[model samples]
Target: MTKTFETYSNIQSQNIRFRNRFGIEVAGDLYLPVGYETQKNPAIVVSGPFGAVKEQVSGLYAQEFAKNGFVALAFDPSFTGESGGAVRNVAEPVMFTEDYSAAVDYFGTLPYVDRERIGAQAICGLSGMALTAAGADTRIKAVATTSMYDMSKSMYLGYRNGYTDEQRAKLREHVSQQRWVDVDNGASETGHYSSGYHELGFNADGCIVTGESLFPEKLPEDADPVSKAFFDYYCTPRGYHERSINSTAAWTATTPMSFYEFPLCHNIKDISPRPVLFVTGENAHSRYHSEEAYEAANEPKELLIVPNADHVDLYDQKDKIPFDKLVAFFTENLK
Candidate 1:
């Protein structure tokens, strides 16, 4: 069945699978523009918004890129959607970053792709992974991100760097205790730690409780603006997909451990000489991430803010996305 939130008649799409360096099979949808076989094409690897599967916004981006004449591949990350991984619903930083390179590897083998012109585009949380991958993997000639998020920094420092040293210590202790619990239970615990950016899950009894659906059926009266916005997309027919983690479930209880330890996008300067583009909504709560990336990056980087748009707007809002700018960036740099 076609799982993507959007479909295009002008582009050809195929379900494809390839393995990452760890031998886990990653699933993706490859989109090719009309007459793709006639000539070589600059290819792009796309993924993101963290827990979302490829069928959501990533697929939309790929379809649009393909329609605009770039070969685009959007994939489910290592442990989500149709991708293969053990103990599903866990997020590992290193593995996630490697997934970008895996997509590049898949593109390199394609006869219709120009290997030297390959690029990557990530949305939300995966933006950090895209930048990290492009830094070390020179094969990714260019990179771009929309509504960028630095997951590592967020995990370690909390939203807007609100976590105090005491809170950080408490979080570490909680996760460490949870590890022992998992070892004894022979399975990973699952919970809703992401509900409130600052409210990490911890019951009165000190046990993590399973979270309600990530996408609530109805908006809570006191729901934060960000939560409400996310619900409008992930819970509604507009962006909901059965396979999306954000729509149906929660991550493993200790999924934050790796993100806390492994910093990402620290190599932003390494991507110098090779261009990078940071695109974010001017009103997005996550806009700081893109701004920080642009500041840390060396020459040949650009930061673009779409007026009056929020983080979720960039996910599937075609009119809000700067497609022309993205296409021009890749076209100018990938060549």
Candidate 2:
């Protein structure tokens, strides 16, 4: 059984499973507010921050939302954690976005949930996928994102759009060649692009695989600030969970292939009638992602930045997360 990373006195949680459109069984923890059985309540489907499982940050958010009188579901996306899918640790953009809608489907069947008032909160990398789902599925009445990271944009343009034309071409060339190699080898290889932050692991047919563990047992003296911040949360008992990909494993080598072609939130304008709330740390490296998304989004949108906080700080830092603002946004819009 997966351990509960965070819990609240006013909330009750139960393990649940539901199938997505593709028939993949998705696992989730359903958190109900103290008086949930008495009447219908607004709901939120929460997940994200890339490789993390539902037991970590998402679960905490779900519990918090439940404590505040909203029925919330924190789920593991397909192929990660307890969710079912072939070839573990693969990151498929289409399926990931579909998971949000699947969560909506589950909530709509619950007598205690107000389907029309349902919303979603996605953290980190899953923010993009959540927004994409909101754009396509009108069921998600309101959407919010914290510490947003557009994986597609990051994969295509590199961190801070640092990749030059030649660099992008070379990376794409390697990825294409790697696909053929994987087909011939009869297995998906694990590797990461040279851009952004990643620890090096074993070599597979000349590909430098991302490390198995996101952080080492002991911190290295020369670890960069970004890696250090992530390490302090995911590697420590404060936020660590064995099933989380961010805590224990790396994504498959070719996972970035589909992300390169598909840009998330390309249809940000489609979610106009539905409100969007973008929250990020003022000092977070990924603050730019929320800013870019906010600029592209139509009216009925908000961008909230917490002072003196970094990217990972928003992951589990209760004091800096501005939960009141999040609750107010959902309450005002989901009504």
Candidate 3:
């Protein structure tokens, strides 16, 4: 028999839409904790893990936070999941930052939410996006990230390792050509870029065989291990959801074209005074991202690691997640 878990409590959830500054309506699920007696409670806006939908990790995080007494929202970024956008699977770095800011706007207007105590959390690639937003807007009282990705750096440097300038230039050219094709054809192709390590039947190797290979110099000492875990997360039912862009074959080719040029941490140091927390697995492939961002950020910043865990492990492994720590972090800071 399969084990069943009650994912949510007496939580009341609603589907709502909020428009960004660009007038794009973004879809989200707002979870109101039970016993809400018209009292103003701290609100948290949660998103990310890159191509993932709200139904996946973000929703889980929202539900958990709601149960813990915060008004939490899990939203789909513009152009992904149930959010509004013309081209599917497209990622705009600037628009993504705006998405978080828009969520703050929505939260601020809610009667039951303590507008001044609003907090934000982002996972995977959106982590950097949240930081960028917090740096610009003081509305976000506190910010936290999990399995974070410095998207701009990742685009240029490849993965946990690093990439060469020549290789990055080549990738930019390829994506640029693909974007032109999309414009000419009036539609972009949908599919995965590679079979990943799991699909290719290499459980241990974790190498992506079907997609464009990484530059030889970008491979890290632990690249194989991290790749294996990522393959398991994106390929297996454990973390896979049909609405997730990662579950699908490919993303809009133009996404990389824009991502390569976006600079996420240009003013990162400005997020100080307000606390910033970076959480990643000790054994995660992407822990270095948190370390780097923590170093670049000023004081009132902290980096927390979940020992013996991988990147995907932080996605939904309830037992391993430090819920109490998170609650305490937000509570103290958002106050």
Candidate 4:
């Protein structure tokens, strides 16, 4: 018979604070299982979906991991959520990767954590960040990602539909101008300019309607259905949060500037020997990301498709999350 681990009867949660290498204070929700003991238990660091705060998906993952006998934390990255940074709603590729490394550092110091057994899981854009971390930091023993987004590719080439070279150049020019404006103003600036929607001219009373004009015209045939799934996730209340970057206006115009230049998969082969798990929905709009990353990663890797699931379905859909597999993956590897 399989051993039945007792559910945590009185889990304790608290707002915890830690700092990155850059001295930026990172805030996170720390969950502790009931009857927890300081036996140096294995721990997992969870973050991302990018532009999302710990209060959302990351917190949920942390809580689930804690329930299964692990020390887990979900943190807000610098410049977003409750974390410290001068400009808000900005995304920095380097600093974001540093944030993951910082989490590993914090986990290493905790009295109740088995420092050597630290693992990480990043979702969405943060999955790319996790891959960056796994390659650079040997401290991370095992890594996993769900619904991964190759931010670099998405920034330069658009989504799965891809972008024209002319369109990409125009985007670069737009970001460059925004950088100059911010430098001159000496303060963060915000306002909508020419986004992918404006290029298509599908304005419908201030909202960019996503019908024939937007999706069918610009998106690839294979991506139309997937884009619909992404639309449901971002536009609906199902996973929408006031703090989600997707639910808000485009990030500070200059945010994409750095993303366009940074190639995220440079050292992917370094993660070899250490197992990597890529999880994506079978019908997810972003399944290609996991597939590409899995293909590029070296030996000791896995690609898992949640059957019949869509891209957003893996987010907070308890029935489709494959918790048993996740638990077994981490438990077996962390040992």
Most TM-score-accurate candidate: 1
Model 4 lDDT at residue 228: 63
- Per-residue lDDT of candidate 3, residues 1-335 (tens digit): 11112466488888899999999889998988887657999999999888788878888888888998899999999988889887666678899999999999999888888889999989988999999999999999999999999887786667654565666666666666665665666553543222111111112343213242212223356666756566566656676666777765545545665666778977789988999999999888789999999999998999999998888888888888778889899989978
Clashing pairs in model 1, backbone N/Cα/C closer than 3 A: none
What is the C-alpha lDDT profile of model 2 across 89-129, one tens digit per residue? 77889999999999999999999999899999999999999
- Once fitted onto the true fold, the runs of candidate 3 whose alpha carbons sit more than 4 angstroms away are 1-6, 188-224
* Residue 272 lDDT in candidate 3: 88
State residue 27's C-alpha deviation in candidate 2, in Å.
0.6
Candidate 4's C-alpha runs over 4 A off are 1-9, 188-237
Candidate 4 colliding pairs, count: 0
TM agreement with the true structure for every prediction: 0.93, 0.92, 0.87, 0.84
Model 4 residue pairs with clashes: none
Count the clashes in each prediction.
0, 1, 4, 0
True-vs-predicted CA distance for residue 252, candidate 2, Å: 0.4
Question: How do the candidates rank by TM-score, highest first?
Answer: 1, 2, 3, 4
What is the C-alpha lDDT profile of model 1 across 66-114, one tens digit per residue?
A: 9888999999999789999876777888999999999999998999999
What TM-score does model 1 achieve against the real structure?
Answer: 0.93
Higher-scoring candidate on lDDT, 1 or 3? 1
Whole-model lDDT, model 1: 0.86
